[model samples]
Target: MNGGTSTTTATPNPSTTAPSAPKTSKPGRTSPPNSNSPPATATAPSSASTPTPPTASARSGGRTEHAVSPRLPHGASYTLLALGAALAAAALSFTALAAQFDNNVYDWLFRVHPAGHRPHEAVLLAFDDRTLMDHGGVRGLRRTLASTLEILAAAPPRVTAVDLTLADPGDPAEDARLAAAMLRLPGLALAAEMLPDSSGWQDPRPEFLAAAEAIGHVHALPGPLDEINRMIALERAAGRDRRFALALEAHRLALGGGAIVSTPSDLESGGVRIPSRQDAGRPLRVHYRPSSTVETLPIGALLADPARARALRGRVVFIGVTALSAIPDRLFTPLSPLDGNRPMAGVEIHAQSFETITNRSFIVDAPPIIPVALAFALAAALAAAFTFTSAPVAYSLGLVLLVAAHTLPWLAFLGRLVLPPFAPVAASWSALAACAAFRFFYVRRQLASSEQTTARYQQAFHFVAHEMRTPLTAIQGSSEIISRYNLPEDKRKQMGQMINAESKRLAQMITTFLDVERLSAGQMDLRSSSFPVSGLLDACLRRAQPLADRKHISLEATAADDLAATADRELLEYALYNLLTNAIKYSPEHTTVRVSATRDAHHHLLAVTDQGMGMTPEEVKNLGRKFYRTERAERAGIQGTGIGLSIVRQIVDLHGGRLSVESAPDQGSTFTIALPA
Candidate 1:
């Protein structure tokens, strides 16, 4: 029996919910109508029987001499497999693509502008050791401010921004002087440090506040979850006003007259997204210049005491500490993780902020679609790969994909380009591993079941073949005796014919039953050899002629003598014999049964053509199914057990040959076998 569709087919139970039985007649000549015989067709293999070729529509290939079984009748396995594959594909696709996650949006507001970009544009008036030496400790602070005020008055900066907070004055005189100096400058702005808490309060020393009318609130953006600087917000909330970020504020002040760069290109990111604490975005572009380059410098120092008490003039001057652990300190920057960790002075933070805000060099974001798509695609692929691939290979491939997705986004960001980031590469990979593992185990279980069923079928075939041998032999012997002792000429001839007919029928029944069981059980063995196929065909024809002669069906061979191949000789012969016998059996009484063999450039072909009550297209479609008789064939009173062609298909497959059929209900049927030359 061809496992072709047997494993995929089920038997209709006669006792339960059976269809209406077709009418039948007693067997004297031909049955009046249909009997219990499946319509037979050309041989097809027991394996796959999908109609890749048009002929497959006519019949399935016969079962090969291998562990072949009937196709399973249930569609459950196929449905489940398809469902699993789709799900796996979806999951793998996602994991391989999507990107969306980002943490902490408040950080972008608190940009530490780099001094690189605004070097010549801003001045840093430090209350250094020299300035302090020129005066005294508390008194020196006074001299430094008095001097700064002197320089600012001479050459007023575009807009002086004093990055100083005087909540607590170590020296009141210097603080007072600074306040006095601020009042003199027409457009000087004093930075007020906002409280780090949610209250959003500022700590501008009363002295400084009383002197300077405008307060430039200074607040660093919130750090990402990982403490990295990746984004900064354009807007920030202050006491009563929704204020621009420090960088924005500085830029606004610089362009107070509204004559600086106006393009979106001027601001990094156009202040769209905020940074995540996890990491800083790509580095900003900066152009640092010495304080002397700006008008707010040492009033007049083309080349004085190179590093003097007063060098800043006509520019934004920020003052702060630079020592290690000045106060509650944190000075991390994106320049380099290891170096950025060191505590930084307040003045440098202002420098960084000023440059960054002014330069507008910032990190772009990962696109929204990139991450989402990646997640879906990777998830699906991983699921499928895990389903079929080995654990190590699946994991390894998954790892590579994950790394690729992750690295790709990061690299794009570094290049000032945006891509998606929220991809579930890691998750998808793991899921595939898990899913594939489950499938691996599942397939093993199914294989075990199939193997067990096949073994049981083999046992049944052996037992049945053994059990039927005795009765068949007895019937043949009895028929022979009755034929030999005929009383009259007509009686003798009739008896002889009956004996031959019965003996042939019995033998055929036994062969059909044995072949079906053996093929289904996968117990058949092959004796392969290269031989003249012409001789084999001749032998099969001689053996099948008696049956053909009885029916007045003419059988003839028409194969090219040159055709030959290296295949299982016995199996090939049996398969060929089966095809020829079927042609003779189903053929109309007067039709010519023609068998032919030919060789092409790449293949050797064998064909059997019969003019008989053939099959409809639909009936031809499922030709090799065990016990599946065509409606037309059954209507023709064909005496068949329905396992012959199926067994033939099995043998053909075992020899690496193909079987196909072409037939129409009214037209004669033709079966072709192709073997690679």
Candidate 2:
């Protein structure tokens, strides 16, 4: 009867022990324990029982607690960067840098593809050097003109346009001779020039003007960038007086002499449409025929053989100086070799302009919005490329986009549409580079974060195995001894108490570890309340007094009773306790550990000072990193997992506090936690 009572009292309750029995039991076996049961079962009935599995509601709540908040997708950053790059390029397009590039490209297109298969509607009667020499060095200009007109009247050209300005009066007898020669032509047009002041036109003398049918302005403006002649202004105006270009006047006379009907965008002369916009000063892009293809007759050639006048029959004649030294009217064309090495005579350029008007071959400029639209399109393509595709494939597609930007302008030019080459190319390159750099850095950051998380998890496992081993072993051993023997009541009670104490310690460790992790991840909600700082410090000192006594160390704490802090009391208590224990554990025997709390202007400062084997400045800086310990502690054989300070730092951070340390080698360390008042 005595043995039965002892066994009943010492044995674990059947209801509590029954659940854990299956953990060691083999599957599909329901027999009671036998002599053959493994030794592990003997220690399984401990106070540290495994926790029950959570229910469905508990698991669902856990997921809800840890779910991440919505944020902007990673691709959005890349897309925004691409847009910025493209917009910068578009803004730069309106500057002179882009226009210069466009001009160069326009010239390249003309040089590569000259006009083909055009009717010769105009002729150039060049006054070469030989013509000037034969006419006595420009002094006999009136005699030369009278002789050339006599030969031209026999064949009778449709219209004769003189490019030389007769605005000033020459010798009266010579001027009258030239005026009579001009009246004998079937059709005559005299050249006028704009005065230097731009106030009025320099018209021919009254006698010369009376013999001519029309007077046109002889002005050929050069390109702003390189002084190359790519286009001509068809109309010039001074106040209310306006005059058509020399080429236009000749075309009008050749088409049987009718009034030129004008609109803002174009001109209509005798049924021919000319694309000359008024807003742009009636600009016309000339389609230059090759110099070799133009029908040119020097004045000396006509005088040497009268038969050469047949070539001028029924064709509008442009008479001007072709000798390079005779006139400064020479200008560069797109077809000029080496940019400006072979300049074309002004008379030939006018003949080409007339041919362009007659042949109806025009190169039209694209609208201003077209380049901007293309830039945006290129940016969008590059953004999508980096967003949805891998790096290698995205870069390959980017290369292709760059090539398309360069080639599109030339292709458009072939179709008779002029597109600027700068905006699309600049935008595409800038966007590609920007997107690639962003993706590169973003991927590197994500990889670094992943590596850090993996390392932290590995450290956590080490901490769990190291810190919980002693308590788990004590609980298991105590349970084994209590379960294997029949003993006195006092002895059984003692073993049971040991198991209970170690099991509670293990549970506390787990709870503290979980709290620290939750707080660091921003998943734990702090419980805020006002508590006296002195009361909190006193409680932590009491808890750490035993450890200090074991090492023969004294603890000194100072706090004002009236001082208080608004924070999570439980978490703050844990933090203060951790600091106290660390101070006591690291201090030398008979040394003192100090704990103090005080309030400043805006914060509650809690400090811990220890006289241990002190730390270097570098070690103090690294104090709060998990599993990081100083060399002094390791050499002193101190028993620690190095996770205590990390937990303390995390807890204080949750209360909107900062942790600071002041220390040096061989000097005691002071750690301070400053909480917002």
Whole-model Cα lDDT of every candidate shown, in order? 0.52, 0.78
Q: Top TM-score: which candidate number?
A: 2
Model 1 over residues 1-677: C-alpha lDDT tens digits? 13211111112223333123222212222212223542111111111111111111222344234555447422333234434543454444344232113221112212222223333455555544444444453334445555656556666555665555556665666666777777777555666555566466465678767755355555444343344433344444556654344444555566553322223333323342323222332223222222223222322231234344334444555554332422343434343223434433345455555665555444455545565566566655565555455768867766766677566655664454455444444445444455555556766887898897687567546655654453344444434434333344653454445445445544555555655666556666554568977777777777676656555666667655555777766567767777877887777665678777778888888898899777778877787766566766667665454566777776677567778989987788999988888
- Candidate 1 at residue 219, lDDT? 48
What are the per-residue Cα lDDT tens digits for candidate 2 across 101-163?
998999889888878877788888989899998887677776788789888989989999998
Stretches of candidate 2 exceeding 4 Å from the true structure = 1-84, 171-174, 271-273, 338-340, 367-369, 441-562, 568-571, 587-594, 609-614, 650-656, 663-669
Q: Ten residues in a row with the worst lDDT in model 2?
A: 3-12
Give each model a TM-score.
0.45, 0.78
TM-score of candidate 2 relative to the true fold: 0.78
RMSD of candidate 1 to true structure, Å:
19.1
